[model samples]
Each structure stands twice: as C-alpha cells, then as structure tokens.
Target: MYIRSAAAVSPQASFEALFTGAAGYQGEQLSCIEPDYTSYIDPKLIRRMSRIIKMGTAAAVESLKAAGLEQPEAIITGTAYGCLADTDAFLSRLVEFKEELLSPTAFIQSTHNTVAGQIALLLKCHRHNNTFVHKGFSFESALLEARTMMGENEITTALVGGVDEIIPASHALLRRFGLYRANGDSLRLVNEPAKGTMAGEGAAFFVVDTQQSANSLARLDALQTWYKPSTPNRVADGINALLAEQGIEWKDIDLIVAGRNGDTGDDALYDLFKKDIPETSFKQYCGEYPTATAFGLWLASHILHEQRVPGVEGLKPRRILLYNHYQQTHHAAYLLSAC
Candidate 1:
C-alpha cells in the first residue's frame, strides 16, 4: 500500500516543526498543540466536539485534503484511551449527580468508536468504518486491518489514524503506577537512568491507497506485530522472519526507528534487538503513549518522502524499519521504502 498523504497534531505543533527543531520536548506529560479547529470544522460543531474528537477530525481532514480526496472509501482509527476527557467528565457527573439528571453528551462521546464515528459523520462517509482499542497494539491492529482490506479489494482508499488524550486524573494515576517519569529531560529520555518515561498524547492520520499516486509519500512494504515474544532471541527471530518475508536483510534496512520510552525494562528489550544496527528513538519527541507508534510511522514516512534523516548518526536512509513495543509484550515492526 502507498501513503498518499499524512498529517499529525501533537505536542510538537506539527511534524515539520518537529523535524526542523522548532518544537522542543516539554516535560513528563506532553499534550498536543492543537490546530485551529475553526479552519477545519464549523464553529457550531466545534463547540460540542471534545479535544480528542477535534484532534482526530482535523487530522483526518488535513490528510484527505493533502491527498485531494473529498472523502475516503474507508475510515479506521486506533485509540488506547478514547475520549478520556469526556469519559472522566461523565464519570464525575455520574458520581456527583447520583446517576440522576445526567447529561448524555459526554456519555455518548466517551466510547472508543466515537472518534471514528465522528469523522465518518463529518465526511458523510458510510462505508467500512472501524476502531481498534487493543491497548498498545491498537494502532498496529488498525493498520493491519486497513492493509488487509485494501488487499482484499474491500476498499480502494482509506483514512487511517491513531489518537489518544491525557487527562489530569489519568496522568496522576499513571504516575502513581510508575509509568510516567516525574522529572527528566524528555529529549534525552533514552539516556535517563530512571524507571519511567514521560507521557504524551496526539493524533496522526494518513490517506492510503492500494495503488501508488503522484503524491505518494512512501510505500508500506510490510508490517508485523508479536505478543509476548518471551525472550530477546524470540524478538530477533520475529524481526528476521519479517525481513525474510519482505525479501530483505538487516543490511537493507538503512535505519531502525525504535520505540525506546526510557523505561529500563522496555528499552532493554530494544537494546537486545537493535544489536549494532543504525538506530534512533522517537519517544523522546512524542513521549510515551500506547499508539505513539503511529507518530513513529509518520516520522518514518516523512523521512522516506523527504530523503532526509534527522537526530540520528549515520548514513542517509532509503529503507526504514519502525519497531515499537508496549509493556514488553506487544511488539510491531513496519518496513517503509522511499516512493
């Protein structure tokens, strides 16, 4: 499959800003620097939309516009925590109001599918809409499904995305659980000798098709995900299997973009798999989120399209490998080639 166009809204403002060093990592929890919603959505509709909804819809719209498509034939999204702000609000209301006279808006928008459904409603698209919420593998699952649907001729073109939001309550909870680093330089997260990493939230969308286009950014050569590999050798075997299936070797991979979130345990797994290959990390820029690999995918696609590699030491890349794992169980790899 080919990515016709891509767009993302994150704490770094925009992907271009992120690559150009205009955006800097802030702290432990990075929130998206949202775009002007009025430009992409009507003022009236924007009032009722939650942050996640607005982020998802704006990204989808921008991607479609860049691809010159009025609407996609299919819409797919992956979200680890969907509409969390609204979910929190609804729960708070349920408790405060004792389940009486509760407003339905928050409840209606709290579901995992709400983002996907809202995008479809905005585009008036009625075909092949879905959302995945499988924890860290959520985005990978969505991409895998979209690729399969395209290969099966279920749809010629699709809009795919991953979105998540961080609320104060949830952030506090995660901090208590030692999932977020309390203090550290987010840019040097990989070097931090700490037990936790920063948290972040963002939305990224891509317009993809089975056929290549004049505006194609990159080609999706292959994607594979594994669960609980059990050992570093098992992870290595998975990587080798994917390379074999794609008819490429480690030498063919010009760069390896890894998901190192500064967590000692999780980064150790990547350390075992990377093994002397030219490598870099994206979590330092995007922070740690379940579907943050979507941001890694966006970064990989941009590097291939622009033919430039930033923040990494070594040769310029032509073929890039994106590897991400969450909780040391869900591991995913995607191969992208310059188009």
Candidate 2:
C-alpha cells in the first residue's frame, strides 16, 4: 500500500492554510480550525453539512484531486467521534422535542460511517466502505483495512481518512476525566506533571493505491498500534520491529515524523529511546488530534517532494518519525521513511 496523496484541515495552517509556515496551536485544547468549506464544497450542500462531514469530505476530495483520481475503489475512515456536531445537534433536538419530532438528518449524519457515506453520495461511488472509531487508534484501524483491500486483485485507489470534531459537552467531559486540557490551555501547562497527553480534534485524508503510482510520495511502509507502552525501550522496539519487517532499519530512514508535542515531551512515546535517530515533531503546529498523525504522513510526503521539512516546534531534525502515544500507555506509531 502507498499514499498517492494526502491533505488535512487542522487548527494550524495545514494544507493551503499555510501562510508564513505551518505552526503550532497553543489553544486550551487543539482543534482543527477548519478551512474554507466553500472552496472545496458546493454552496448548496454547505449549509447542511455538519463540521465532521464538511471537513472530512473536503480533505478526502482534495486527496483524490491531488492523486488525479476521480473515483476511488473504497472509502475507509477513522474517527473517535464521527459527525459529532450532528450527534450533538440531534441530541439537542431530541431534548427539545421530547424525542418525538426529531428530524432524521442529524441522526443519519451522526453515524461513524457518515463521512464515507456522504463522500460516496457526492462522488456517486458505491464501492467497499468502512469506518473505524477505536479511540486513538481509529485511523490506524482504517489504514489496516485499506492495506488489506489494496492487496486484493480488483482494488486500487482507496480513500482513507481520520477525523474528530470538538463538542462542548464531550470536551467538558474529557476535562472532568482529565482526558483534555482544562480551559483549552497549552498542554505544556502540565508537561512536568507528565501524566496527561493533550486533547485535540482534526480530520486527515489520503488517496492510496496498491500499485506504486508515480505520483505517490512514499509507499505505506507499515503501521503499528500498541495497547500499552510500559517503557521507552518498548516503544523503540515496536518501531524497530516494523522497520525490520520491511527490510529497512532506523539508520536507513531519512527522517522520523513524530506526533510529539511539547506536552508529552518526555513521554517515551515522543522522544526516541535512541538519540542517534533524527526526528521531526508537528503537533505544536497542527495541534493534537487522533488523526493528526495522518498529517505526519502528509509531512513525510511533503518532505519527500519539497526536499524540506516544514517549521515544527522544538525538534530540529531532518528525518521525520510519526510516533504518537495516545493516552498514557496506548500508543500508535507510523514510520514515514522516505521513498
């Protein structure tokens, strides 16, 4: 599997949001500020779109356009909270109407698969479709599915994405549970506390194909998700295992794109066990999102194309490592070694 194209809309100036350079977001909680929906989506359909659908579809469409693909063989997406705006809206309506006169629009859009469904509707595609919402590993789940389908005889040009929208209720709830930063403060506020990872929301999508298209920045090297990261060495071992399997080692990698933010600067998940390996961190600019790593993959592609790394906070390395440690122990890592 390989990524032909990748696009994202996040709190920071991702995609066309770039002005001076892609920078970090220091808000209380990381949120994808969203791009101009009108530019990528039709005005007629714009008003009805919930944030999740609008952002998700927009990223997916840009990826397709970038890949020079009109239609994809499959649509796979990952989101911890899919169509949250619609979910919150529907619930609000249910409360107001006592659940009797509630419209089905919000309810239908709230499903985890709504993004995939809406993309299919607009693109007139009825191919294999799937969505994953496995907490922080949601996008990884979607990638897993795409990897399998890409190996199939008839499948090619698959669309994969990850998205999450910030909702007041859920954000508050997460704060209460210590899952998010209170008052949307910079996560570095608790960096020394060393127990909390920042809360973030975003949507990232890509056009993938089984065959190595000339347009592809780099092939899908491999993806790995872990239930528990007990030690720094353990996380490094996990990364090494994936690299070794591909007959590639850490030294051969041009860079390691990591999901590391200042908040978890010391979390063995961000910095590597081995200091010798070069790395690049982007969450400070893109903010923290479950799918933020998707952009890490995009940055990998960008570096491969532009032969330069975007301005990321703190770290000063050339090679990128897209390593993400979601929650305290549960983590996911993607090695975006240059092709």
Candidate 3:
C-alpha cells in the first residue's frame, strides 16, 4: 500500500515546520500547535470537542482533503492515551459530586475510540471503523490492520491516524513515575542521554490506498512489531528479519529513523540496533509519546517525497526504515520507500 497523503498537528507549528527543525520545546511537556479548528469544523461542533478530538479530526480532514477524498472506506486510529482531558473531567466530577448527577458529555467522549468515532461521525463514514489502544504498538497495530484490510480487498482506501493528548493531571502522574526529564535542556533530548524524556502529544493522519497515484507520497512497504526482545542483538535480528521479508538488506536502507528518546537504556538498545546503519532520531522534535512514531512516519514520508533530508546528520534516503520501541519492549519497524 501507499500513502496518498499525510497530515500532522504536533507541538511544532506544522509537519513542515517539524521537518525543517523550526519548532522547539522549552518546558517538560510539548503540547501540540493547534490549527484553526473553525476552518475545518463548525463552531458549534468544535465547542463540544476535546483537544484530542479536535486535533484528530482536523488532521484527518486535512489528510482526506490532500488526497481529494470526501470520505474514506475505513477509519482506523491508534491512541495510547485517549481523551485524557475528558476522562479526567468525568472522573473528577464523579468524585466531587459524590456519584450524583453528572454530565454524560465527558463520559461519552472518554473512551479510547472517541477520536476515531468522532472522525467517522464528522465524515458520516459508517464503513469499517476501529481503534487500537495497545500502548506503544497502538499506531503500528492500526497500520498493520489497515494493510491487512487492503490486502484482503476489504477496503480501497483508509484514513489511518495516531492521536494522543497530554493533560496536566496525567502529566503530573506520569512524572511521578519518572517518565519525563527533570530540568534538562529540550534541544538536547537525544544527546543528553538522561533517565527520562520530554512528554509530548500530537495527531498524525494519512490517507492510504492499495494503488499508487500522482498524489502518493511514499510506499508503505512493510510493517512489523515485536515484543520483549531479550538482547540488543535480538533487536538487530528483528530488523534483519523485517528487511529479509521485504527481500532487501541493511545496505538498501538509505536511512534509519530511530526512536531514541535519550533514555539511557532505550538509547543503548538503539545504538546496538543501528550501529551498522546510518541513523537519525526524531524524539528531539516530537518528544516521547507512545504514538510519537506516527510523527516519525510523517517525517519519513516527507523526506522521501521531498528528497531532502532533515537537519539531522544522515545520508539522503531513498529507502527509509523507521525503528521505534516503547519502554524497551514493544518494538516496531516500518519500511518506507520513495514512490
């Protein structure tokens, strides 16, 4: 399958802004640079949507528009943390009011599927719709499901997205677990090699189809996920296996986009995996959300389409390999090629 079009709304002003290294993070949490939702959604409807919903919907709309699609045959989304603001709201109200009458709006929008469901509702797309919430594998799972659906001739085109939001409450709780860096320079996230990384959230949507067209940005050649590799060599073996399945070798991969979040353990694994291949990190730009690899995919697609490497020091790539892991357990590799 090929990506017909791609759109992203991240902490960066835009996807292009992220690609050019024009965006920066100053604090611990990197929130998305929201677009003008009113431009894509009605003011009335926008009033009720949460931050994640708005980000997801706007990204999906832009992706569909770029592909010249009014509606997709399928809407697949991946969210590690879904609608955190609404979830927190409903729970706080439930507690504060002592289980008395509560508004259903927050509760209704708190589920993991709300982002995908809202996008479908906005588009009136009643086709095959699904959402995956498997932590780090969420986005990869969505992409794999879409690929399988297309391969089975179940759908011609699909809107695939990865959406997540970082709320203050959740951010504070996660920080308690030592998941975010404490008083570290944001620009040096990948180089500092710290115990934690900056927290971030964003949404990225892509219009993918079985056939390539003039609007095609890049080919989704292969996607594979592994869990709990015991050793660094095992991680390398997994990548080798993915490349073998594609009938290619390590040398054929012109660039490797690594998910090096500056965590000492995770970066060590990445170093072991990419020791022989030219590699670059995107976490410095996107931060360390579970679905941040979606932004990595968007970045890789742009690099392949524009034939211009980002400011990262790496070879200009014709075939790109994306390697992402969560907590050093859930590992995924996505192979992309210039179309």
Candidate 4:
C-alpha cells in the first residue's frame, strides 16, 4: 500500500520546522504545539471537542484534503489513551457533584473510539470505522487492519491514524509510577540516557490506499509485529525474516529509524539490535509514548519522499527500515520505499 498523504499535530511547529531543530522541553513532558482550530474546525464545534478530539480531527481533515479526497472508504484510528482529558473531567465532575447534576458531554466523548467516530461524523462518512487500543501495539494494529482490507479488495482507500495525549492529573499519576524523570530535556533525550523517559503525546494521520496518487508520499512495502519475545535475538530473527520475505537484503535498507526512548535499559536493547546499520531515533523529537511510533512512521515517509534526512545533509535513501517497541514488548517493524 502507498501512503498518499500524511499530517500530524505534534510538538514541532511544522514538518519543515522539525528538520531545522526540535523544540526543547524544560521538564518531563513535551506538549504539542497546537495549531489554530478556527482554520480547520468550526469555532462553535471546537468549543465542545476536547484536546485529543481537536488534534485528531484536524489531522484527519488535513490528510484528506492533501490526498484530494472529500471522503474515505474507511476511517480507522488507534489510541493508547483516548479522550483522556474528557475522561478526567467526567470523573472529577462525578466526584464533585456526588453523582448528581452532571452534564453528559464529557461522558459521551470519553470512549476509546471517540476520535474515529468524531471524524466519521464530521465527514459524513458512514463506512467502515474502527479503533484499536492495545497498549503499545495500538498503532501497528490499525495499520495491519488497513493493509489487510486493501489487500482483500475490501476498500480502495482508508484514513488511518494514532492519537494520544497527556493531562496534568494523568502525568502526576504516571510519574508516581516512575514513568518520567523529575526534570529532563527533550533536545538531549537520546544523547543523555537516564533511568526514565519524558512523557510525550501527539496525533498523526495518513491517507493510505493501494493505488498510487500524484501526491503519494511513499510505498509501505511491509509491516510486522511481535509480542513478548523471549530474547533480543528473537527480535533480530524477526527483522531478518521480514527482510528475507520481502526479498530485501540488509544492505538494501539505506536508513534505519529506531525507537530509542532515552532510558538506559530501553536503549540498550536498541544498541544490540542495530549493529552498525546507520540508525537514527525520533523519540528525541517526539518524546516517549506508546503510539510514538506513529510519529516515527510520519518522519520516515517524509524522508523517503523528500530524499533528505532532517539533520543529516547530502544523504538520500531509497529504502527505509522503521523499528519500534514499547517497554521491551510489542515490537514492530515497517519497510518503506520511495514511490
């Protein structure tokens, strides 16, 4: 399948801005640099949608517009934490009001599949719509389903994405579990390894189809995911098998985009996996989250389309390999090539 158009509401100001330099974070969180909703959404509707919904809807609209399609045959989304702000609000109201005199708006939009449903509603696209929430494998699962539907001729085009966000309450709770450091730097996230990684969140969307369009970004050659591998060698074996199945040799991969989250133990596995494969990481730019690989995929697609690495100069790649895992589990690999 080919990724025809890709859009993101991430920490960086824009896609080109990321190549210039990553935005820095002072503490243990990297919040999104949100765009003006008046341009993408109706001002009245914007007042009702939560942060996650706004971000997801904006990316979906931009992706469809860029793909030159008013509507898609399918809308699929994956989110590890869905409508977290709404959920937090609903619970807080429930506690404060003692289960009385509470509005249903927050409760209505607190579902895990709310983003997919909202997009479908906004586009009047009453087609196949689904959402996956499988912890770290959320985004990979959504991509796999889209690929299967396209391969089976079930759908010609699909709108797919992964969205997640962090709130103050959730951030505090997660920090209590030692998920983030007390103080950190996003610019030096990968360069300076530590015991914990910063909390990051964003939304990324793509228009994918079997047919190549004029605006096609890159061809998604293959995708694979593994869960709970017994050892690191198993991960390597999986990578080798995927390459062999596609008749692609290791040398054919011009660049490897790895998911090194800046934790000493988490990054050690990446160091062992990529042995002199000219690998680079995206966590330093996007921070560490379950669906952060969606950001990585977006970056790789642009690299192949533009034929230039963000910070690296004068090196063009025809084929790119993207590998990411969440907490040493839920491993995934994707092979992308220039279209």
Best by TM-score: 4
Q: Which ten residues in a row have the lowest lDDT in candidate 4?
A: 271-280
lDDT of 4 by residue, 157-241 (tens): 9999999999999888889978777788988888899999998999999999999978799999999998999998898899999
Give per-residue lDDT, candidate 2, residue 138.
84
Model 1 vs. true fold: TM = 0.96
Candidate 2 vs 4: which has more lDDT: 4
Cα deviation of 275, candidate 2, in Å: 2.7
**lDDT for every model?**
0.87, 0.71, 0.87, 0.90
Clashes found in each candidate (C-alpha, N, C closer than 3 A): 0, 17, 0, 0
Q: For candidate 4, what is the lDDT?
A: 0.90
Cα error, residue 197 of model 3, in Å, equals 0.8
The C-alpha TM-scores of every prediction are 0.96, 0.87, 0.96, 0.98
Candidate 4, residue 114: CA error in Å?
Answer: 1.2
Compose the digit string of candidate 2's lDDT tens values, residues 18-114. Answer: 4355444444566676778888888898878888899888988888899999889889998887787788889999999997988788888888899
lDDT of candidate 3 at residue 264, scale 0 to 100: 91
**Arranged by lDDT, best first:** 4, 3, 1, 2
The 10-residue segment of model 2 with minimum total lDDT is 184-193
lDDT for 290 in candidate 3 is 88
Off by over 4 Å in 3: 19-21, 312-315
Which candidate comes out best when scored by lDDT? 4
RMSD vs true structure, all candidates? 1.4, 3.2, 1.4, 1.0
